[model samples]
Target: MRIIGRALAAMVLLVTAAVAGAVEEDGYELWMRYRPLDKAAQSALQPRATALVYSGTASPTAQAAISELQRGFGGMLGKVPAADTQLRNGAIVLATPASMPELAKGLEALGSEGYQLRSTVVQGKKLTVIAANSDKGLLYGAFALLRAVGTGAKLDALNTSSAPKLQLRLLNHWDNLDRTVERGYAGESIWDWWRLPDIRDRRYTDYARANASLGINGTVLNNVNSKPEILTAPWIAKAAAVADVLRPYGIKVYLSARWSTPLELKETKTADPLAPEVAEWWTRKADEIYRAIPDFGGFLVKANSEGQPGPQDYHRSHADGANMLARAVAPYKGIVMWRAFVYAHEKPVDRARQAYDEFKPLDGTFLPNVMVQVKNGAIDFQPREPFHPLFGAMPKTPLMMEFQITKEYLGFSTHMAYLGAMYEETLREDTQQKPGGFTVAQVLEDKDHGQRLTGMAGVANIGSERNWSGSHFDQANWYAYGRLAWDPQASARELAREWAAQTFTPDPRVTGPVVDMMMLSREAVVNYMTPIGLHHLMGTGHHHGPAPWVDSLGRPDWNPVYYHKADRQGVGFDRTATGSDALAQYAAPIARQYADPRTTPAKYLLWFHHLPWDYAMPSGRTLWAEMIAHYDQGVGEAKDLRARWEKLKPFIDARRHEDTANLLDVQVKEAQWWRDACIAYFQSVSGKALPQGVKAPARTLDYYKSLHFPYAPGRG
Candidate 1:
């Protein structure tokens, strides 16, 4: 009996040791985790990935591609491939036409940044080839090869080609010099501003690798509310160090230029665009920057929005300010990204119309080097908004689409809301400006205009957190943003599937369910937070929780009450001719469609019209009851997200699975909090009883309204 007990204890100990040997991932690798594949997959890939042959010049970019392939093959197949000069069977050949003309045939059309992958025979040896026009394209091809294998593609049958539709794919970091990220829900800023240029973090290299994998070519290192000090020699040196690390990966560093830098630095008496001294100061500053970093991408200016100084303060047009800086950078072949998110201190009849009213007339006046960066929506980054009218309105001026990857208005980092659907919805929206089905994607690509400078910028959510993004799932948003930036017309659903397969196991059973969860995630947030076109109902200042009753803020548009305008009579702001005439900004077809409440899509019904509580919805329910139903439905979906994830636990490592499960718990509570508070406040105004099947608020209106978060994670 004693021997039997001892044997049982020994067996248990051996089992524990084996389980512990299987390391748990902390999500720091992101989607680039080239972990060992299953035995069958490894065996299948090993033959094709046995050797790497490069025929191009041994430049730094080519070396980077070689190193990445070795690292990926080593991890995925448990053996690094040998580098060989001679072509052989199962060799992965990388080349440009100048180096290996026969191997790179028909690859010239791919352009400098595009790549072609094929399985072909070269001199009687069947090999897989990665051919491009330049070293930058070779780097992209390397990542593509690894991505294909990591996502469970068969190597022997490889045949694909890819090119970025957009000219500039960038990540706009709102990181401050002090390391606080404005509207950033992650940890502190990843850029160690104080320690940079001398003591660079290895994480910077990883950041570049991740961005390069997604074809993102540029990064703005500071917040749009820029500091003049960034132009000083010390900060310029810091940016130069970051640029050195990213250059090999085909990325250029850009800065957010403070509009009044010359004036603030005391170099010029005024920052007026017309002033010769100010222009001279800008030219000298550009020269200094180019001296430090020769390939420096140019400036991203905020100018005249949210109290940031611009040419408007000097009684000049936006073009005047943009052209001044454009000329300064044009000498070095750099470009300027001038933002179009501007509004006045004094509120207009409709705040949404302010940007269009100011910039529409000045469309053709901007310099060729200047691209106007426009946010996806006319208003702030609401969960749901009509696509901005300026997409097609500015045909002569190049426009760059700006998307907020962080979830400031969509419940921050705690909630499990995937934003790919939101981005796709706006991209697919028809501007109806042309006769043959014009879309926002078409407007951005501008193929009709000869495919001139085009771009997409996502406000980065990266931070110093272990996972880079605040939460495990939040990393998907970053990945999706980059993929869509590379190709605006790419399907969000397909991107989500690719991300799921790479980030986790590539098994179809796991990826299918994960993609489904991501597909409906954004709509769930919309239902609970701001359903049916309602926008900006969050608490003032911090923007944390629900606060529909507070209307005492300084600016009328700053208050939540100003947006919903709820009363005993009805809810929603009227944007039609009957009210603010904001709808006139859209093309005539859309204006006509939204003129009547009956014709408008239900999702945007309240956004453009204020309907009575008793108005009949398509669902055969009153508007009041419909709103309540949406709130309840959203809460249920949040719970469903958790339940769906629970089933995935067996397939995922316990550490990441449990981390996501814990956040899902918080998300469920927050979703209920959003639902209950909104229903309670709107009910008070409507003076109506709860719908028959709906649950009443967990607490009173006073209890919900009394809550405050002065120390929220992203208060800046």
Candidate 2:
């Protein structure tokens, strides 16, 4: 019996070791895995590491910090550091100033959730100190140190203190309950709603780890075009289970609320915000949600837009609807994120002016718990767009910028488009409304009494794909979103380098070329797909491939022809004062710049003004010639990206390298397709001759127009 017991113990030990070994190999663990480094890097890291000592009682957050330290140390150094209850020589101490009076004196200058990591000696002992205002801050500090080490930075004199600029950094998943994600690529919805409360997938825990590492604090699990069924008792329980897993990582879960939920789910007669009975119904629903998940983040509502029912259905304004939900969740300290992407499909007026027209008047009327969520652009997430008019228009309302991390318009995951540039471009645009420094970042980082309660949300592109997002490079966009959300002021270029180092390797041979490729990627896509401000030119419904000629769809706004209005003599939409007067929506300085085609940036020329084919461009070429050159340039760049990546074959892994190589090949082919197809169709309408050195389309305009894509991958 003793020999049998010894054999069992040996078996258990072997199994544990095997499982840990396997986890180390899986790249799915992302940056948080903290696997041990190669010999050279490990040698650089070992001298700085000695013993782990934490100064606080074991709270969940503190335990999380300890667990991360253990995991990172074990993987990076091949051994976990021994934990000491007290600080000593060659020891690493994790503590808040309040927890250690001596350390508190040193940490007096640190900000909230900020930490100071310094090499110091106390009582003839050398130590590395991780001091913060709270244990959560310490955890963040530890992660930052690990990141620095991972990127092969020198560990000596590691004095660093950091805090998130934004309080709420969230990802909004546009996933439906039926597992059909709207504009979602990669795979079906990740939320396993049917089996959730009873069965928790380990993937949920991994998702939490990835998010926590990037300082993303919240996630909205469902689509903004929400279903009322998600608010039912059974679904609430399922959400609570997800919230439970996320809670440990300091992430709160939010739900998207359907405006007519009371009417559809509860059988209420009316869903009016002004109605007492409707208000009562919402309070009850809020209570039910809080009962199941005590720390539930509040609702995200997409009201009166895109055929979704809203308070406007009952003649109530958006503020009325948002305030009603805010009142219901105010007691629980929850917030209401009301989407401002509203426009009447039936309205023939400028789509760019609609959101501003609707919400700008209601400023300051919303409750403190309510935040008006505005998309980065006034129009849909186009390949390129001017800053939304609402950024500076609503001074009294807390505007939370919504950026689509998903590749809905930018060729899904097939074309390489780095959205970090897109995000940064929109945020850094000087609204030029306020007399002094008033960037979009300033509006979002607005504070009350030195306390920043601002928010930023990105529509997630993540799914159940092996690499998380569909393509390998798509992962960088996710990383970029989190970093930017934490600090809106962060440079996309700097973050690109950091992400490349962590994701691929610290080798400049690999990272330098990759960063160069990423920097120009978004512009390359824009040039090929919708260069010079041409928008909504993709095929109807699924939005895959080029179909600038698509004029027939269910609704007028649904057709590509409704947007670009190309004809016999010219192309491009006319949004100038003489046309839709959409230019009037922006500040006078910006409006004047956009209203005149001569002054408008050549990249956004077609967006703000209609132009004749004879229009002279800054490049000493006609609009027709320059437009053709851009398309040809885009195709050339795609080919160059493929060639550059192929050259890095020796540095990158065979599987990922080959995968990216294949995707780049597809990108080149499709870029040519967009060029040939768009030029062919435009020539058919405009009757223009091809410029010198330009090749004519292989297929006729009709052939390109007749092409059908009834079964595209992400059509659901």
- In terms of lDDT, the best-performing candidate is 1
Residue range 1-716, candidate 2, lDDT tens digits: 99999999999999988875654332465556565688987786675676788765777877777788778878889988887788766677787767776864556555666677777778977777778887777777777777887777766667677678888899999988888777788687778887789999889987887887788889999999899989999899999999998887778999999999888865688998999999999899999999999999999999889899999888889999999999999999999999999988777787888998889899889988899999999889999988898998887788899999889999898889999999999889989887875788877887532552588999998887777788888888988999899899899998888888877777899889999999989999998889999998998888988898877677777788888889887888898868888888888888888778888888888888778998899899999999999999998888888898999988876667777888899999999999999999888878889999999987888888888888886655
lDDT of 1: 0.92
Clashing pairs in 2: 35-75, 36-75, 36-76
| Prediction-by-prediction clash tally | 0, 3
Q: Which stretches of candidate 1 lie over 4 Å from their true place?
A: 1-18
- Residues 298-411 of candidate 1 have per-residue lDDT tens digits of 999998988899998989999999999999999999999999999875756688898899889998999999999999998899999999989899988999999999998988
What local distance difference test score does each model get?
0.92, 0.85
Per-model TM values vs. the true structure: 0.98, 0.94
**Decoy 2 TM-score against native:** 0.94
Error of 2 at 202 (Å): 1.1
Cα misplacement distance, residue 306 of candidate 1 (Å): 1.0
